[model samples]
Target chain A: MLTNRRTLLAGAGALAAGRAFAQGTGAPIRIGLLHDLSGPFAGAGSVPLSVGAEIAIELFNERGGVDGRMVQAVAADSQSRAEVAINEAERLVSQERVDVIVGVYSSAHAVPLAQRMQAQGKILWINSAIASAVLKGKHFTHVFRPTVHSDQYGEGSIEFLAEHCERATRIAPTQFKLGIIYEDGPYGVGVATALEENARRVGMPVALKEGYSATAPDLSTLVTKLRRARPDAVLQVGYNPDITLFLRQAKAGGLRTRMLIGHGAGYSQIDRLTETFGAEIDHFCNVDPAATQMLDPSRLTPPARELQQTLLTRYHARTQSNDPPTHASMGFNNTWVFLEHVLKPAVREGGGSIDAMRRAALGVDIPVGGTIQGYGVKFNPPEHEMAGQNGRSVAVVMQFENARSKVVWPTPIAGGPPVMPLPAGSPFALR
Target chain B: MDPFLLEAIVNGILLGGVFALPVLGLNLVFGVVDVVWLCYAELVMVGMYCVWFLYTQAGWPLIAAFAACLPVVAGLGLLLHQLVVRPLLSSPPITQVLATGGVLFILQGGAMLIFGTDFRSLGVEMPPMEVGEIFVSGTKLIAFVAALVGAGLLWTFLKFTYVGTAIRAIARDREVMPLMGVDPRRIYLVASAIGGTLAGLAACLLVVQLDVHPFIGLSFGPITFMICVMGGLGNMLGGFLAAFLMGVIISTGGFWWNTEMSYVVAFACFIVVMFARPRGLFAR
Candidate 1:
């Protein structure tokens, strides 16, 4: 009896020690992914982003996660509400105890959530929100964004226009009259402000600038205004419904423009637009991060090419979409960067402390064509105006032809020359 | 007038046409049943989804799908009346309103469960028609003409048919209509079905112009209610006229200022009208 009791005690002691060892070394790294998975933003690239982030984490874990510790993702829906996003972020930090939080789809939600996460001193890696105000002049140490910003979208559109205006439209860049219209939200306002500023810097004349509610039932009056202004090209920023309304109204009002350029959001869903407007939107140009699927594999690093292939294959299997939207690449590439570059090294250095994570993030330096999206990874230092922003991240202008997007700007990466002034067959084309 | 301003006015009238059917439906239900179906717009949303499913998914012809939408929505209206509104007919107006509000959430949640949040478009567009200096959307013009025809048919039914006369009588005097050998319950059900049919008609028109999502109703719902109130709650003609007036105001406001401000101007106009009339613009 004495011998049996002693043996039981020994077994219990061994089990306790083994559990402690597992807790200390083999525990999974918890990442909180906050995105609008079930709200209005879901269809506007949020779902793709969530799916992409999940895929990246899955791939990382399959390859034997950060330094032998598996990575886990805790996803919370923002419901497209800023308050909900903040509350969920707080829960993920205080309750779920996530080491890093990533993936916010809307700038409106990102603005407040970033501030909250920064105050809490928790690391927040932004995957998709693009408003320049999200990082501009806010030298945040804990927040890092590795995707194109709204200012890039603004500048990219103008640059594309300036470079290709004379050649394609027979209109000088200086004489080009640009019309700016946008939904009066943070994303739209940010892009519109940047577009106006960049256009002014380039000495391009802006014919009309208008802001409308995204939920407005009628855009006919705005269409009438556009008709009156008759701008050489119209730059619009809006989500799905408003863009559709504007296009429908523009067609009805015969609001002719030399070209119609859109910045991300609704514009990225070229297939949906094509399904609606058919050939009318064939040459419509959209400024956004290049979908990695559209980029030439030869230009990307060997690893990046493989990653792109895997992402596309998995994404297509999941979404049944042949052409993966740009958001998927942004989500996958940014989360992959965080996991491989920042989290892995941080854990290796010292138990994945927030400070160590910060150091690892700052130390990341990759040249162009290194990532799946063909953008490099180099966060602006904390001392910089837009600290924690990926300064090297770029946006490209892509034209939709036959419901497929082809990059047409930034000469180095462009698949083909832009079709400017639209084709004569388009109703919006200049006669 | 500037041609642009003229264009805005014309566009406003066209927008008015879009608002007319929904306003008439709401007014019709309020007139006969005396219970506000706050879920009216949601019913329209469901009708839109039905049409989209039949036409796009089930591979039915567009016109056939549209024809099927009317009866499907009318049956839904009958079910709603039988299931929800009927039980609450004896309750206070506030209670009825709350019940229908609950139904609104149910419908929205159900749609979310089924269709998800993806915006589904019918992907049908008609070319613009040029009328001198004014350009008009072919889709909007068709919707406008259909709304007028629907309104005319409704007026004809009310004036000529025995059942329609009974519905009118119930709206006129709910207490006395029972004494006049007309069953108020049957009349209410008929009015509700007709209201649903109008909503379905509006849905058919709207699906072509705008993409249909679950929350698409919120875009035009509030304005519709305001139009109903402005025209006098039970007065169909007043609601019809008010829809156009509101449409012109909103469109012209958009013309003068911007789209967001235009809605503000519209609501402000509604407040001013309410302050002056109290009951409605055409209570008598």
Candidate 2:
């Protein structure tokens, strides 16, 4: 027993010694967070993403730093332009010599930056942005994304609904009137295809469809057209304002339906839309991963849970604001995932040069936020898609209810039953 | 297909009346000034953003927001003409194109820096108008009627007003117009100013229908420029006619191919039209 106690103490001592580097170092080791601070996505995409990313870097330092080196995040706002994204990425690499770069808001910005990542030999950590094309090629050799791709969002939505209906016997597969009311764009098109295919596999027929321009002056015409089809559910697609326009039009039209689901626009600048629509959005549905659910008080992994809570508490304390729903939590997890899984291990084995770190970043196994959804992340060499079964695990069916959105579908992580008998003929419902 | 195609065409023509504000004024400038006035397309963009800035930010009423867009954007037009157009007036056509191109950049840049490229849409407080499953917007109908009336008023001014005739006279004979009691500079100013004001009005109407963004101006600029050139460099009738043709092509292409390609199809058709009838649909 004495020997065992001594061994345990020695082990504790060894672990303490081991944590000096893992705890973060005395000197700062740089990570770069480049984002659109003053451009289109600034409100939801740029500021919140950057703030969340910053909190993560701050948390790393407070934990004795990553590998005993203070994890410093040097940030630059790309202004949501491609040239600016490339320029800031170059600056981060040359001036700061950052180990990782996080928070790009547009696919237009990400595709080119991915190419830059390959050439510079650096790790690109992607969180939330919808440019489906980013997952198409292996150009960004040093990048790893933990979020679901655009295509999978639709597929996941269909799958979730199918699984739910099968359990509840609400709608038979044959009569499932799946419909799509989508923005006419590439990302929208990809999602549309995913939904159609997935719905078909579940034996549901996509009955009604319309592709409207996001730039349309008013969505009334589209809403009227969508109403004509009288679909069971409509998959309303677009970015922030598209969602807003559809919701407002649906409300004014007094259209009701079984379910109303927005495309994966839940984590966007949805606050504006919520403010405008008021309680009307309570019945609305949107697709965003249950990232925070994984960080719940009960289920956090040893190091990860502590890290999650520390960052959440410290961030709220410093900002004097509530911890962002999943915004900061994703950033914090993404940063830690990049460092703990890729950077530190590479440095221990291969000296953590830019090339070494890039190589290691490729081999990461991403697990979903256990408290959120069960998406454990893994990537295959030359396989660029950041989604499939594991990625789908965390996709919680979310509804905006009572002035706040919560996971309301696929129990186990769900807070409440879906508000069934959703407002009749919901223009934004996905069939 | 239920003769809805015919109605779509009729409504498409009616829609052209509203869109003519940009085509007519844009071509008017091109006819006399020989500059494309790329920024003219963005005049509507400026108007929309200004309205959005007022309504959403300053909490102004929609009508007030619409009212404020005109004067502010009119001043913007005057500044653009004075600072940008005047500097490049004597240079080659390429230089003139580049100068007006700079205007597009400045306006778009200002919008981006201020607004950060998020979308801004407006509520008209009216439901969509439908005639037996033919879905159309109440806001769009109003814009069309307003556009038709505005276009007619401009047409009357061109035919009857002294300054308008002088402006027309200058378009016909730029160098010799001074003998006809027309100051080329004043005519140019009036043309650009009128063009700018119309663009601002269109901008307000557009925001009520769709969201506004700086990048959206880039999307609008090239197409309107094409409309002017494809219709005929300086001919209003030609500009008006080709506007519908291009719109139909876009609506069809957006259905058949892809959204981004709507611009490409219109531009490509412009190229094809230029190849078949190099002078455009109407002879200048």
Candidate 3:
């Protein structure tokens, strides 16, 4: 009787295991989010980006979680250190065995994370590290970027300068001399190089290209040099501290130009910038990855608006802050794309295999206005030598007026008209 | 001289004055205790945060908040002296250095954990005072004047006051000063308090101009140390003068070349001066 009972239990356990395996729902899908959750970039970048990922996971799970199998999302803080990011990535992939890794704030952290993910044959949907080197001449099937690249930021900046500077300052595009100042780092240098390349392409003259340490005590001398150069406009790429110090010193030293534009980084931090400078931040322009819902409400597509509202509501409910955070919008949109286009497809077609996911990601061909950020998802193939970059992702230029930052470039989707020439008495007016 | 060159020089001088204020206290503690408070910059950082919390968050007036920063920092300085610096005073200098270094990490990491690394600036926007073509930022000028006055007061106290004499005597001969009826431990504690007060003043002045963050102290730390070394360790006046000179050199270097080159030139000047005068440029 005892032998018969033991045989029956063993048979039942075997049948349950086989049934679950046959249904392709034996184990839950694990997603890892790596971010600088406690570092310098946390307040403006990482925190919001993580929220975006969380919101995506929540919505995806709510919709039945990749073919009836529950999805698990886990996050680890990089502490804004590259070594920490490496350790976290190792744990996420080797220990937790996550299916996908998403969100890294800095290029220093992102580069190593990307290499690790590729070696592990997993997917990495880059949230913000837009260094051009990450994608140029390299094709990693597992590494894909949904946000605008640094080079694109440069190109977008010059294009905006040519289109808006001429109208705002009444200076002809050919006559305008652009002064470019960038932090001496990979992100800044890459963007600056792109700015120069695009300036040459658009027939705009670059008067001075200066690179400075982000932590330099004062920028008076740099401002003095730019003043002597007498550029009609100045373009800068810098981190938060550098941008804050530069603007303060420039204002103190009375450095004036027709137009002043920042290509992402510090400029994209709208709430922090306003808190620090109040009205002083007005009249400046920033060219950054476009968050379509952040533009004037009327311009947002209904679907995009709904997604944005959901993200903001979820974020506000969690953090209790007044305004919707900046980096989360991109984070949510990027994760959403991966879930909708890649993960669900792979789970259905190939039993949740990574190779299937990669193939699905490559074949993704969503048109513009389909994603929450108003960008399409079409990864370039090896023939284009741009295998993993989102080719259609375009950045927008925003102008700050009366404590409001609104997209004012790419006329078709502009939030408002660009305020040109700055008022005569303004701190940034052209000499 | 080109107007811009002249402007850079003037701004450099003012920047030096602002830089000097923070280093003066570090100079004092390093001199008397024979211990390098490696966490000196973090002391100033803590003071800045105190000012921020009291003024910005609590809705206290700026001056009152500035005044509140002093006692709080003084208490912290006293606590640090008792807890960390006092115990290792007799150990090897390396032990003292490492202990203080631990304090630095604790304070920085603590600030990051507690306050978070969001940039917080004192929103005192006094317009620049324009005289002809020269524009002087009101906040910077106020800091410069405060530094000058604070330096003067510190000089008078050190030169004339009884406790100041005891502190100096302790610095000159720590062993003999106790025999002279002045308690060395007591003097060190008092000196630490004074140093904390100075940091408080510097923080209050700087918050008007510069933003406050967790690792901000690191940004200002090395250069301030360089200034102290160039001024002659423990020599207040020397540090003060060296700061302005280095500031001018850096500003002019930046104007003529670039920002990194300016720092290189400043470091080069420090090396040349140290090699030529082992005691330092302004060391008595």
Candidate 4:
């Protein structure tokens, strides 16, 4: 009888607290933008990513923010340091009391931030960190990755290579010798492991697999080895500067292959690559999660095109360049989805409670064509190991044609057919 | 010998020649000033940015940009010596190292702010020179020839010119040279200026082949320092020989394995040689 009375009192106290929160007593919803603003990653990633998130916030406010309550964002720079990211994350949560968190550009920064968000039961929407380990188990339920992981690139490349090689060279997949050169990092290892598995499954011969540090001074030796192997195809996993170095050295060292596929970290930013290498960068290909905003007009829905234009304009305004960094598109899409489908719904119903936000996010199921990237957002089954992964995420292959890059694989979305037999050759040839 | 091995050797030698100029400058500054400029690599980075800005952005001729890089960087070097190096000259060696390290940060950060971290290249392409079975990059060959010419001129100047003679005397003993009517401070500033000019020349050579970014120095810095140490910290000839030896070792190792393993092999060679002769490769 005494226990029943205590339970009744506890329930009444909760109801009173809810009533107070509902009656204009609570503060506006706060979202924290955690990104690397100053370190090594700041240039290629953080600045544009920050702008992408801010654009999303700006767009939301223009539309009368979530359920008539103001949404404020607290921004913190990670300084491209993992330790700094941890400290900044703590400050964002403890002092700022952020309702949601977004933005991470590298696995080094993302891994720790994911753990914290999971522990705190707060949400972290990942934009660019592609390491598969981030979504490995049940521990990452609070982390949602709309961007495709590293493994997807491997599978996508193999699929595209199989078709392109058979159609162009009339060579069976089994006869093709593959060479892999990758940076010795989480991102590279993850993609390489997947590429190896997929290659084995498809009965392709693996001739060489070499790993080098990202900051390696020269790639002449690796290129020489690859030249000796003379593989039908080569897969490179690296960042911007190393990609530039490797390509230049490979050409200078006289290393040639039938096809060179880059698992897009720096390669996806084709404008920068082109500006650095010019016409010499032609015939290179990269596989990444499709950013339909930058794709051919026919591939995008009307709404996506509008959103893309808005994002492009905002990015151009900030960078004073016609080209937008790839990260900016990703940043805008991820943040836009969270605000439109998750935070707004939760705020409308539950006075911006974290639990309510999580529920709303889990229930979100935007169709493939609905998103700006032309891919839907639906979390994988809760029972699966990849429960945090966006199930609709698929990889797309992009190839450099002349100076500009265009999507060339997955026929429905391809801007053009794949450029095969890497050295200058006909579009339709069997050699 | 295998053709591939022969080509690798040739490439290594050429690379060593390119590396020699910057290392030579580093050795000169160390010999005379007794100060290790940790920001030496960053100075090269700034020079590269200047080349990019002058040639690519401002549409200056490549030759003009190359010429401008020298004095511009020499001015920067003099300014640095005046502000940072001279102030802490009498302090402990660690203080000098720390101050130089601060300059490195400033240069790197300042470059990023000014250049915006976008990778810029000169887009200067020259057809590879085919020699027998191997193809040699024309740009690298030019860099090698330029290095040889620069080294020759520097050697000639030191032997023939009065100012250069005084600079050399000061290197022998800064305090003792004062009795010989040489101002050590003026010699130190000249040495720093010469060092900067050499770095600028290296930047012009490298900018053609490599992308220009704030972090470009890091790729060459540690290895250049290693070569300087292995060649004898202050001996110019020793440093050049050590650079070629390191280059050949690195190239051969790279051919046999990967860049990382090649670096390990080069480091191992340096460690062994340093132990065998504490004074360095050309120890008198």
Candidate 5:
């Protein structure tokens, strides 16, 4: 009970020791990883995407994590449903108390989830979900997407057509008749609208535009419509099931086009399409952010190149997929950028507060070819029209040749010239 | 008529042919067993998986795979009867519906565990045939012919064979047939097996057109039930006719409007039909 100097000194020393220990190894940073782990989108690319994000977190943690604070990923399955994604995201933020949330596979889910996160003032780092509407005009200070948007996808395909239509198909760009067909979902609608608008801007004639439910039992009627319209090239936007159904019906209904371009989603599953259609999809092109593995190693920065290799090796080991879908690269690259660039600096500056993270994100200005996807990182300012969107993300046009994806557009980074009019023997090819 | 409109009508008829098998199967099960196998489309999904496994994974010829699918699905139907439906036959109708709905989830989860969610296609397509101003899908044509053959064979069986006649009699009057020395239970089991065999046939046709996935049953299942109910739930001929009618409406709707709007039109037509005939179009 006596107030002795020796006892007081001992108590103070113990308190100091505990505080020092806490300061040296701070509390683990919790990241909520929301993605469609089951249901229809799981097979589409969501599973691999979530796995890729997990690998990034695991790798980061292995390297002692940001500022000696281990990153903990609280994974939740959206199940390819918007309601589920919103609920899971709410639980992740309110119950699990994650510092940041990342990885939304479907644009339909992301649109609502992003709004909910923005309203709640929680940070959301989107690794996928390419709908331009997610972050187009309504600038959310906390929501950021580093991936190419639907506008980029639409523009890339049109630009490729404009540049090479005459050389490949012997048709001038102005005379080429383009047809657009899409599933009537947020993702499909977003891309189709972009395609139509961009096509008109380039003076390209659109022969037909049709929207159908992705779950429609038969697409034969749509195929027949396409046949009647007689478009020189067709641009399709759909998920896995609808894409397969459309192709099958198109083949069966004798719908022929000089060329076909698919915008991401189902188009990224080259292996599955090949399994179903064999050489039929040989010249089918897709517009998406470059799959990290598809890029030349020399183009990426040294650190990014190493990260790319690590991601591919771990991804193949995890998924047993020799061909990594673009979604996987998106998951790994975007998450890595958030960790190495945003979270690390934010933690050092202000103990990783939400505001600190936002400042760090906006402050990022990586130049071209800085990331594994060969895209730079620079978020548009809050005052900008497309706030929270990555200003430097790029989309490339890639064509499938013998079940392998080869980048064929944006000549500087392209692996080869676009195969126009599709080589003979493709079922959809013009004779 | 516009050539494109004609093509749309032809495609609609072919689409109706695709819907016919499932409608007939559901009608048979509902008519004879007097219990709705809400998992009927799930049965077809399983059959699809079976055919896909046999042809693609096990390296069986497509025909052999189809042959194996029928018996496998038939056995599954018998198992459904023995394990699920039979136990709840004496329970309320609502209880039976719940049980079958549970089976739907079980089958879906089981398929998901076994096959994952990847959409698997049979990867078989036949070239399109050009008929004077229209293009006909070779695969749909084959499926249409096969469906007609399946319906005829089923019709012949019902009209000629003793078991089939007993089954029909039981469907007509469950109490009267038992009084006439027909065992309704035995007839129900045979009807379930026949229903499953029809589902297998439907699976064979659908696999060539649509990719097979665990949740694929959701795509066409509701429409199949709609067709069955529209035609008078237990009326096989009514269901057959209704399938064609609905198919034409959908195809023509799509031709006139857009793909998404066509479904809207079909659903609207269905609502109107239901309101006009609550007991169904051919209830008597």
Candidate 6:
């Protein structure tokens, strides 16, 4: 009862605050642009976050705005905490009174915030929260995740490895030893489940499986276990920090393995890790989403490029520095994707209600250059996944060359082709 | 003693010695002033992170990088003692604990906010100067030697120095110590300063061995606290002995069995010994 009272009072206070912001802006619609502007995840976090909101606003205005009304984004950083994210969500929905809230992230912190968004009855679109359960869960609605889940990379990675790498190049599974060292979080767990299933189905012998507690005094013990396993190619499925630790310890201990590959979610951000660790970094591959190509600015369609160009220009202007074009591009892509496919058409169809917008989103088809990851944005109602099961699988295995990851798989998207038995065949000579 | 037990014993002692390097300052302050310096572990973390940042971020020379780091961590410790511990002397002990804990929290948040939660491993180019296959990294060897020297100097200070005696006097009784013209307050202040310096040095050594974060206090504090307790609280030999014992147990135990269970086994051994002898393994 007390909780109910507090909720009511908080609701009333929020209504008053929203009235103030509405009067100040002379706009009826509100959109919350919540993000993690601080901490470790903040590095890659803002690409899908900070810039995503700006692009949506431009698109909304382009299509005569929702309800012939102007939209304002209530942008704030959640700082990667459930409590902070929840508070930010409430501030966006109740206080700022945004018509929709977007850009909550990284599974460690997004779950509770997602719950709060549902409870608060806010229209929320998640740009880049990685756990598959968010899309798969039954309770999640009014929340649309346009980001790729962890397992999406597994099918792509397994296929790439089976077809291209030395260990799996033949019909027989040769040199098929597998080892996984992951961060032991939900994101790690999701990726691990998919990798294990896919690897087994593809005929790799499981040599060792271990979960390293980040809280472990040091990872020397885990690394030692890894060294002893001597797997053909050890797949280190962890965040950047853990990957850095694994590589450093492996080098220090004189551990040798044929290769090291990252599950799509971790250890991909540091563009110069190979250079940082020297020869010890040896043959490493990261399963990363393709880098945002809109940086070229000339390849995009008119409406999309206009929004993209403005965001790229404004982002540079506002911060006096360029935010990584990838996340900012993804962020913009999420809001604009929804606007281009769902909201604009919904308004055109005179279906301004929430159900109408969702219905429009269901049938929407997106093309390449429509998103930061360059995937077509479409959804089925029951699944609500950006890429439903049996979706397109694309994992580019990028190798370190003179310290930077040079894409070397998928032949087409991977700038170079994989010539196997690895450094045995000079990978750095541009394929 | 069995040769294996003797081996275990020796290994434990060395490991504890390394563990004590980081938290020696905490023992000094509490031994003299009855203030449990909780921020001691965080000091080590900041030192580790500073080492990572200086070498990796600033691209400073290894020697110059450490020189820059030591003063920084020491300065941070001194600032903490001044801003937090000093202001709460008259308050209740709980208040003092809360204030120091707050300082720990703030340092942790500040580290996260500034440097980020990334694990920075410099892979600091240190060749393992071998000792007949019991190889040691160059940086770890330097750190181990420094821990011994630092602890020796501290042992001498507490045993022979005038301020050290006054600090001991303050530990016995605050009011009586002042009657002899020794201010208990000054003793506390000096104790904190010395503690900060030692803590700073510990941080420098740890950065060479492990990845650092604002949460590094989490790594060192509990381990060191257990070391201090296992060595018998307030007994430097006890603290020092227990730290190495815990270290060896964690290392060897982790090496042989599950790494997570190593802390459990070490703590269990410490507890059994504490029960059999109500003090520590080497009770004062």
Each prediction's DockQ against the real complex = 0.40, 0.10, 0.32, 0.27, 0.39, 0.23
Cα lDDT of model 5 by residue, B1-284, tens digit: 78889999999999999999999999999999999999999999999999999998899999999999999999999999999999888899999999999999999878876787778888788878998768899999999999999999999999999999998999989889988899888998999999999999999998888899888898899999999999999999999999999999999999889888898998898889899997677788
* lDDT values for all models: 0.87, 0.64, 0.79, 0.78, 0.87, 0.62
Residues A187-238, candidate 1: write the lDDT tens digits: 9999999999999999999989999888788899998988888899999998
User: Model 2 over residues A294-408: C-alpha lDDT tens digits?
Assistant: 3354554555566656766765664444325555555566666666666677777787677777567666665544322345656545553442112433555677766566776
lDDT of 4 by residue, A242-317 (tens): 8877887777766667788988667766767767666666777888766555476555677767887788787676
Sort by TM-score, best first: what order?
A: 5, 1, 3, 4, 2, 6
Q: What tens digits encode model 6's per-residue C-alpha lDDT throughout A1-431?
A: 01111222233235334433454434445556777654444543343355445545654654556655555555666754567777777777777666566676566656666666666655567776666665555445566766566776666566677777554344345456777767666677677777788888888776777665544555555555655666666777665455665665565544455566776433554432543565544456766554454123444455556665666666555344322334555577677776667776765685456666666766677665555455556564554443221132134566644444556665555666653434543321112
| DockQ of model 5, rounded to 2 decimals | 0.39
- Candidate 1 chain A, which ten residues in sequence have the lowest lDDT sum? A1-10
Q: Best by TM-score, which number?
A: 5
Scored by DockQ, the top model is: 1
- Each prediction's RMSD over C-alphas, in Å, is 7.6, 8.6, 7.8, 8.6, 8.3, 6.8
Name every residue pair that clashes in candidate 4.
Answer: none
Q: Which pairs clash (backbone N, Cα, C closer than 3 Å) in model 5?
A: none
Q: lDDT for model 2, on a 0 to 1 scale? A: 0.64
In every candidate, how many clashes are there?
Answer: 0, 41, 2, 0, 0, 14
Q: Which ten residues in a row have the lowest lDDT in candidate 5 chain B?
A: B109-118
Cα error, candidate 1, residue A429 (Å):
1.3
- How do the residues B1-284 of candidate 3 rate in per-residue lDDT, one tens digit apiece? 68778888888898898789877888898889888888888888899999998998899998999999989888888888999999888899999999999999899878876776677888776777777776777778888999999999988998899999998888778888888799888899999998888888888887777788877776778899999999998877788898899889998998888877899999999999999987778887
Whose lDDT is higher: candidate 2's or candidate 4's? 4
Candidates by DockQ, descending order: 1, 5, 3, 4, 6, 2
> On DockQ, who's better, 3 or 6?
3
TM-scores for every predicted model? 0.93, 0.82, 0.91, 0.90, 0.94, 0.80
Considering summed lDDT, which 10 consecutive residues are worst modelled in model 6 chain A? Answer: A1-10
